[model samples]
Target: MALEAIKNQETLAVLGKKFDVSPIVISKWKLELLDKLPGIFDRTGSASDESETVDTEKLYAQIGGAESGE
Candidate 1:
């Protein structure tokens, strides 16, 4: 799918016309894509960036003894 087309401010009817797909199909695609957003940050063999392993103790102390939001 074209990113430009996805970003355009077109109605579902217009988008369906341009892509030759029904609005229901387009909505399903959009929903499927949206549902994948969380995996973008999940690290357990997921699509998240960088290594999955980490030293939690060091990270905890460095940030704030188990209270830091970040």
Candidate 2:
């Protein structure tokens, strides 16, 4: 059921209904599964896109010297 939920990208509540578990239980299971997913795959680790940053080298080259704080 966890596998099905992950595979189908369905909500935990949806999977919970199918498996006859409470949504909160399913939510916890989903959290655990997500926590392990990166390790399980090995090839794809998690990364964030929220806070953008620039490489120091690229910043210096592109923006040039003191103004860019390189």
Candidate that scores best on lDDT = 2
lDDT of 1 by residue, 1-70 (tens): 3332367588656776676555555665567667775675664653454554778887445435323321
Give each model a TM-score: 0.47, 0.42
- All-Cα superposition RMSD per candidate: 16.3, 17.8
Q: All candidates' lDDT scores?
A: 0.56, 0.58
Over the stretch 1-70, how does candidate 2's per-residue lDDT look in tens digits?
A: 5566667677766776666665555565567788878766454444554244757796344334323331
Tell me the lDDT of candidate 2. Answer: 0.58
lDDT of 1 at 23: 57
Q: How much does candidate 2 score in TM-score?
A: 0.42
